[model samples]
Target: MSTYRLSNQGLEIAEQARQAKRWKRQDEKLARAALVSVATLKRFWGQQPIRADSFEHVCRALGLEDWQRLVEVEEERSLDFPQFAWDEFWVGREKLVVQLSERLQNSCRVLMLAGMTGIGKTALAEKLVLELQPLPNFSRINLDHREKTVEFSAIATQLLETWKQQISDSDRRDPQRLLNWLVSYLQQTPCFLLIDSLENVLRGSEQTGWSEFIDPLWVQFFQKLLAVETSASTVLLTSQDSPAQLVELGQRYGHLYQCCVLDGLTPEEQMSLFRQIGLLVEDPVVCDYLSRIGCAYEGHPLALRVIAGEISQAPFDGDVQAYWKRYGDEIERVKQLQQTAEIEGPHDALKLAQYSRNLRQRVRQRIDRTLRRLTEEVPLAYVVLCFGAVYRRPVPERFWLRSLEGRSLDENQQLAVLDALYDRYLAEQVVMDGDLMIRQHNLIRSIALDHLKNLQP
Candidate 1:
């Protein structure tokens, strides 16, 4: 569909109209009306114009006649968005919350949480943000890989506005000046900063100032800030891999930095989430089904969330067991898709080549990155990855041990291959009836199996 973006003037009108009508706090409502995500709306609030159709939809939602009419309203600059506010229905993790709070309160200036995909790190970070006081002093920046423009200056400028830190527009665009101002602001006013998907900053190709110099330089600036006597109240980061720079800082200044490797939710928490999401909780058989499903998915939060959503929707009509029997495998693949989420712009049959190219790039890039790395680093691990892909069920220790037939690796070497897979978050380990079993996500297995088939010659 053709999209519309709100001009600077139109954005101001939307913001004023939203506030005057009490739609500011109703973010989900505004997002639905605009046909976009809350994060997308937050971009508009940050003065980054919205899509054409989205602008019209938002204008209509806010009782404005049209985009042209919205532009007639004077621009409003005295606005500070507190970002997204979600009504959290989280279950369990009281102890973890207490620990996180204590770490931040103490001398720990930077707290890092690392874990496998869909382990609820981001959700917990949002919860901690909500629990903080002086909500205006707290803000989050999601370094989402999908966005076309995610410059450090853009984020820093938005943050300064949110925090009411006065800096010239020209000065805010300069990395050194921005960091200096940021350190000064933190020293005077303690702020809680939560940055999610931090690895995106470090992983991509050399593109812009942020990708090459500014990002690495920003780290050095933070290193100095952390070393100083006066520093932030807390800086939190969540990512799949731990930044080695921060790890070293944590080692040197143990009191100033802390890293927490998150684990999957407890069985109780998983079951509780399913029940709270309005699943078929009353059914006795549903409980048993959830228990099995939960274990199969390793109690990953996103997997359970998708399952809860699927069962709660129509056609199934609250028949949890029926849905389980029919589309359990299909439902499991949703988790994999989420890890490598992508947005496909409108295309046509006339653009068949373009469409096929986009399709191949999306399908190949996700797991191939890791597979190529594994093949180079450890050939044995690559073989294990390929051979193990044939089995859909969780492979037992003996089954994996036997798969080393064509490969000449010893048993210990084979076990190390499994360890490498788990380390990369490509595989998961499960304890089924006290027996350790290894499993990969449904789509992940399919990808590896396809690659293996191509190399069969």
Candidate 2:
């Protein structure tokens, strides 16, 4: 059941009503009058979530006629946005939301959420746009429309024509003029633009090695946006790969551009997600079992959600142990191996595998597409990833480089390949024993190990 608290104005009105009724201000007295526990009374007064029934009783106790009137209203969104399951699936990233919100409001002009597929970049971007609603103008273009591929020039022309009705036909026909009109209009009119699946518009095939814009007009548009001394608008992009031009522009205009790389959910966050989805996490044994699954997946959001759904359904019926009883063998073995690796060293750690073959199709397919792209475009980076997966725990940068010593790459080329792995969010950085090290997620390592096997000796 959903819970709610009093609105700010409602709280003030409730206080006045209480005083008019000549009620004692003591918490004990109020709790007795409201017929709720002191904890519930306190929760009501503190503006924390309380049951609707409890809230109504408290409101009646204060002589307020309408309890519904006192409850906070839902936030109103002014702009038209595609609907998403924000309340259901969105969890964690609280700090990230605050950080990005501040940057977008104050300093940052163009922001990008860059990460691997299924990493929730699009979800987070949608969340940001929703939270910042009621703006004067808002527009979004999803580049993932395979049925009708969207072009940069088309996007710019549409925005210009819609926002500036008086735009000359000649300007809309000319790419440079169309971009200039859009940029100039944006500089004056404060707006929020969200572009999703930007990689669809990028040159990411085997020939291009990822990141270059398919349409040169996009490069010019972004350059002009960031190069401008000031702009009244901001744009947010979600992409599987970071745009090379944006990276270079970020170097030149550091203050105006920001790129946030997303990773998997934390263990604590994963537990919250499991509980939210009706999994039995209250039991310590069950909690521990789920935690191990999280470790096995390395807190991958999609994988954890899939596993949680399985446990919450049918014969399992939210019985984590029962789910474990069937699927726990591999998790148990991985747990033991991880413990041994901490002492025996990473080499002793067995190569981790993906989710059991039967259950991993969705996450597997998603990750497979990304890995296939990497394998085709930047084989050197892909090779580094395969070699680096031999370590079960985070290792130093030198070790990743050391694995490539036999290859033809020089120092600079090797470093670039390592950077490429990081840029694509394939390699993760962690601090262990007060020293920073590199590691790969279990799922990625599983696939990488498979690729490593196919490499010619």
Candidate 3:
């Protein structure tokens, strides 16, 4: 059996042209036969300019329809991965998929997927398309590729070949007309269309660009699609952010679903991901420490991956303190870079010495200011907090608030200080295990501690 196939109409036309016995003019009849043969070849393969005479002679000797049909069937089939593959990809966003599917299933001509960076929203959208890939008329357009520009006319051209329609010159050029033809094609054929990274088209520019041309064109095209009396066609769009105008239109028409916010993985999911990524830890102590850091960082997949990559290359006998020291050095280098341009002084032999002394004094004063806020007496609490931050884990509030004897703080004073910190946006209170937990962002904590460590009386 041949792997590709032509439509029955195409096959019949080719057969009749081949079997034509009465040649009123032999040359004209031969030319028509050659034209039919070329059409068949172009239909099976894509548009290619080749000698029609040779193709016609071959088709006359063999019935190529079955071979063509089989080839087409095989070409349309999707591939399945090996069963033993690692499958590091995400799974089980059924709720979000169903929500999107329902919106696509409803009156909305388009559905948009929006989420934060690195949340796996694109994976979910691709998964949905994979689910729908078996459908005959389904097609996808990836807008992320620089070489491709998606216009209604281009979409219609791809659809024409996929649907095996007779390409009329008029149908190929008119976007509005082509869109109507596409809607009709989709209605009868039940096609699923996916437009990925649609944020590209939605981005506006100060100069004339795609946002000026494609945006309004797609808007009108979608409006026309919605107005059409169709039941089966669906268009799914994936973007980083929701298109404001489209969202407004969807709201007015009550066709949009509530946007789903994809968040970082849960602790259990993060563990599973780590295992999949080939990080196997048998030591309970090390595992517990890494897990604490992971939880503190909100189980953000990228951050966990970075930490895992660092640990995987570090010496097996290396301690957590060594890792902290290495990371602290890197942080100090970054701090110096950040402060370089902010430093200023005069240039004279005596003045230069005085300027250097003044700069050192100012640095000490900054350190003192940071330490004073953390504690009045020892001023070492800031140093401990900074060292703790290098581990990328939240320090327990009691660790910072403990007295010289290491006793827990009185509730009233603790609450007052916490309230002040919250007001100043220095620390945020997170709820964990039914208790108020205090934590600061990693960068701020780093700066606070770096200053405290440099402080001298």
Q: Number of backbone collisions per candidate, in order? A: 7, 0, 11
Mind giving the per-residue lDDT tens digits that candidate 1 earns over 354-373?
Answer: 11233235434544755675
Question: Which parts of model 3 are misplaced by more than 4 Å?
Answer: 1-87, 91-109, 205-213, 255-258, 281-284, 289-457
Show the lowest summed lDDT stretch of 10 residues, model 1.
344-353
Prediction RMSDs, each to the true structure: 11.6, 9.2, 21.8
- Which lDDT value does model 2 have at 98? 88
Regions of model 2 farther than 4 Å from truth: 1-79, 84-87, 145-151, 161-173, 204-210, 341-359, 398-407, 430-436
- Cα-lDDT of candidate 1: 0.61
**lDDT tens string, model 3, 1-457?**
1123434554554455445653222232232333222233444334222223334333443444333332223233323211111122243455766766656555555666654333455666666665544545666666665357656577667766767888778767677777777777766677777766665565422121112224366776666556566547777776544454565556665553344545567777766554433344445765565565555445545445545444444352224345445443443343343335432111101110012233224323433343353453223333444433332334466644542223354566444444434322345567878876666543345445454345423
Per-residue error for 71 in candidate 3, Å, reads 23
Instruction: Please write out the lDDT profile of model 2 over residues 97-137, one tens digit for every residue.
Output: 98899898888989999887777888899788767766557
**For every model shown, what is its TM-score relative to the native structure?**
0.59, 0.74, 0.47
- lDDT for every model? 0.61, 0.74, 0.47
